[model samples]
Target: MYVSVKGGEAAIDNAHRLLADRRRGDRSVPALTLDQIAEQLVLGVDRVMSEGSLYDRRLAALAIKQARGDLIEAIFLVRAYRTTLPRFGFAEPVDTGAMLVERRISACYKDLPGGQLLGPTFDYTHRLLDEALDGDPEVEPGETREGATEPVSRIADILGGEGLIEEEISGNDEPDDINQTPLEFPLSRAMRLQSLARGDEGFLLALGYSTQRGYARSHPFAGEIRIGEVEVEVFMPELGFAVPVGRVQLTECQMVNQFKGSAKVPPQFTRGYGLVFGQSERKAMAMALCDRALRAGELGEDIVAPAQDQEFVISHCDNVQATGFVEHLKLPHHVDFQAELGLVRTMRTQFEQAESAMENKEAAE
Candidate 1:
C-alpha cells in the first residue's frame, strides 16, 4: 500500500527560513568575508577543492562559507557547481619534473640531490594549541634562498638508474575519463588514480593506516614527497603550440614498496604514485599507501584486505555518494511504516481470535 501525503509546503518553507536564520547566527559579529576564509582557512579550502575535484580556491571558499564551515557540505556544493561549468579542451598534462619546488623531502635518503627543504610544514611543530593565535600576531618573514636554476632530480629516477626500483611505463594511449564513462570492473590504473584522487581524506587515511598496521603490509617507504607549483598549458589548434594558462599548487608522493620477484623477474622495489590539486601532503601520502595496496594483484601478492579490493575501495571512497545514500533514510517513509504497522496488528488480532475459540471449545468439552 503506497500513499502520498501532501500539505507540507508552508512547513518546508518555514523550515528553510529557520535554517537560514540559524546559519546566520547572532548578527552582532561581523560576517565572514570570502577572502578571510580563502586565506586563513587554507587547509579547509584545499580539502574542499581536492575532494570536490575543482581547483578554484575562491569558489571553494564560497562553498565553505555557505556550508557554515562544514567541509563535506562545501565539497558537495563545489561538485554540484562543477557540473554546470563549460568544458574547454583538456590541458596538456602538467609536468611535475619542472615544478618550482617549495618543499622536497625524502625518507629513504637523507642526503639526496637537491637536499631536503621543509617549507611551511607542521611536521616539526608541537601539537599544543597556542592561545596567541586567538589574536592577531605579527609573523616574521620566511627566509628566502637562491632559486634552483635546473629542475631537481626525482628520487625514483635515481633508484631506477641502478635497477633497484621498477620502471615506470609510459604510454600514448588516451586515458579513460571517469566523468564521461560509467565505472566498470577491473578499472585501468588511470581510472583508479582519478577515483582515489577525489576520494574522502578520512576514508583514505583509515585505509592507509590499515596497511601500516599489517592488514596488507607492503613494507612501504616514503621515497619522496614534493610540494610545489606547476604550470598548466593548453594546446592551441590555431597556433600550433601549447600556451601557458596558469599555475596550480600541487603535492606529489612516490611510495616505494618491497616486491619479491617471481620466476621471470628479479626482486625490485615497486612504486605507487599520488597527486592532488593543492598542498595536501597527508592526503597525498594516504593515497599513495592505498594505491600501493590496490596493486596487490599486479604485484602477485594476495588480496587479503579491504584496501586490496579495488571494487570495495572505489565504490565506497566517494563521501558525497556515501552521505547521500545514508542520509536519504531521514526522508519520510510514513506509508511504508504504516503498511508494516497494519500487517502486525492484523496478525495479532487473528492470534487473539484463535486463542478465544480454543478456550471456548475446551470449556464446552
Candidate 2:
C-alpha cells in the first residue's frame, strides 16, 4: 500500500505534466489569446461567469483557457478564485425594464411595443460552418437605423393588467446569501433563484427538459427574453443616494406558464423569472423553467416531480460538489475494502461450519 501510494503520487505528477503539454498542443500554431477567447468565445465565458457567480470576463476567459474549454471545470476554477477576494459593497438590484436592450423577443405577443429586435441571434443562421471563419478576418459593421428606441412593456405585466396573469407582488425582505450561510429547508424564492443561477447549466437544462416532457406538466410560452446592458448601482449610506457602479450585459427570461384554478388561487398565468449574466439565452430560459418547477410548493401545486422537490434539485445542482464525490472514487480505498472483505469472509466461514455440523448430525442419526 505504501509503495502503491508513492507510485500513485509520481504517476499523478507525470499525468499533470502530460496534460499541460496536450493543452498547449502544436507549438507551431499560434496559441489562443485571452482577448480572442473573451471576444470570440463570449458565450463560453458567459456560462463560466454565470455559474461561477463572478462577472469578470477576463478571469472567466483565463479559467476557460486553463481548463482547456471544459466549461464546468472553468466555472470551478473561477469559483475557487472568487472565494479569496474581499467583499466590498453589494450592488443594488438592477432595473431590467430600463435596460438598453440589444435583443428583445416574445413568443406570447405578435407585436410588442418595441417590436422584436433580433439583434445578433444565430436563430436564422445555417448550421453549416463557413471555412472562411477558420482564419482571422476583418469584421465589417452592419448598417444601423436612425429611429429612437421605444419603451418596451413586459408581456406578463400586460397580461396581469387584464387579470389574465397572476399578480407578481414585490417583497421588501433582503435575500439570504447562500455562500455565507448553509442552505436550510423551506428556502425563499430569492435563495432558490440564486441557487439556480449558480447551478450547473447542464443539470438545470435537463431538469427543465423533464418538465417539458410531462414530468411536471406546464403550458409554457416565452413571455419575454431580453439581452441587454443594465446599470449596476450601489447605495451610499453617507450620501443617502444610489450611485452607478457600472453596466453589465445580462440575459433575462420570463416564462409564462398556464395554471389551473386551485382551492386557494384562480386560474391565471403564473410566470417564472430567470436573469443571468451575459448572452446566455438557453441557460436563462432553462433556469426560468426550473425556477417555475421549484415554485410548486409555494404555489400549492403537487410536488410529484424531481424538479418540484427543492431539496433534491438544489442538493445535486452544484457541479463542484457533484464532481468531487464522483472523481474521489479514483482515490485508494484499501481500508474500506479490507473491512468489506473481512465481513464477507466471516459470513462464508459461518455458513460452511453450519453445513458441516448438519452433515455430521445426519451421519450419527
Candidate 3:
C-alpha cells in the first residue's frame, strides 16, 4: 500500500525544523559571529553586496553565515532584506574627477597626473594554504579618520588634454532602476549600465572574455580601473541644491576602444563605461566590454556576436533572479509531475494502438 502519503502540512513543518537544525549545526562549535564572517570572508561579503545592492557589512556577513557560505544564497538574503528598506529619496551624481581614490591605474599611460596607486589587490598573491593566519590573530590598526585622503584626477584628463577622447557631459536624463521595474528596451546609457553592474559575475566575465577571444573583436585598452569610495548626494529641491547623503565603495572601469575613422571624423578613440557597487574589478571590466559590444550599431560596427546582443546581455545579468528560479525547482512541484503523467499516458496510448494495428495486419498476411 502507498499509505496514501498523508499529512503534508505536518511533513512540511518537520522539514522546516530539520532545515533550521541543519543550518545551525553542532552545539560544540562556536556560533559563527557576524564579525568573523565579515572580516574573514570580505570577498564573500562584497559579492553579496554587489549582487544584493546593499552595503551593510554585518548584514551581508549574517546572510553568508545563514546561507551556509553559498554566495547566491547570501545574495538572496541581502536582497530580501534590501526590499524591506524604505528610501527617502535619490542621490546626486558623483564626480569621478573628485573621487578620493584608494587604487587607481591607467593601462593607456605609464604616467598620469595623479599617479598609480595599487591600494589592495589579490592579483599578486600565490593562492597557497597559510597555516599562520589560522594560528595568530593580529592586533587591529588604529582607524584612520575619513576624508584624510585626497582626490585623484583621471587618466582621461590626459586624452581630453589633447582633444583625443570625448569629455563626459550631463544631459537631461534619469535612469529607471531594474529592481523597481522590469528592464525595457530603448534604455538610456545609465539604465543599461545599472543593469550590467548588478548582473551575474560569471555572466559578465564570460561576455568580457569573449571579446578578448575574438568573438566580438573590438580592440580595447583599459583606459582606467579605479577602486574608491565616492560620495552619494541628495538633490534637496526645497533646499535648492544637492547634499552629501553618504559614501559608497565602488569599482569603476572606463575602456577606450579603437574606432574606425568615420565619415564625420578621423581615426580616434571612443569610450565604454562600467561602475558597480563595492570593489568588483572583474565585474566592472566585464561590464565595460559588454557595454562596448552592445554599442556596435551605435558605433557603426557589425552586431553579429553574442556580446553584441544587447537583449541577451541585459536579459541574463541578474544572478539573484536567475539562481532563485533555478534553485526553486528543488522545492516540491508534484503538480508538474501530474501534468507530465497525463502527457505520457496520451502518447503511450497512441503508440500502442499503432503497434497493435501493424501486428494484426502482419497476422492476416
**TM-score winner among the candidates?**
1
In TM-score terms, candidate 1 sits at 0.92
lDDT of 1 by residue, 240-337 (tens): 99999999999999999998889987999998889998889999999999999999988888999999999999999999998899998988888878
Local lDDT at 327 for model 1: 91
lDDT, residue 80, model 2:
97
Checking candidate 3 for backbone clashes, the offending pairs are 92-233, 199-317, 200-317
Predicted structure 3: lDDT: 0.82
lDDT of 3 at 312: 84
| Segments of candidate 1 deviating more than 4 angstroms | 1-5, 148-150, 342-365
Which residue pairs in model 1 clash with each other? none
lDDT at position 128, candidate 1: 100
lDDT of 3 by residue, 76-153 (tens): 888899899998787777877777787788888888777777767787788998777886578587554354378877
Tell me how far the alpha carbon of residue 356 in candidate 3 is from the true structure, in angstroms, after superposition. 6.1
lDDT of 2 by residue, 1-365 (tens): 53458657788899999999999999999999999999989999999999999999999999999999999889999999999999988999898888888888999888878788788889999999898888778889855434324346777778978999888878888789998878998888888899999888899999999999998967789999998888999999999999998999999999999888688778888988899999999989989999999988777888999999999999999898888899899888887888999999999999999999999999999
Question: Each model's TM-score, in the order given?
Answer: 0.92, 0.91, 0.88
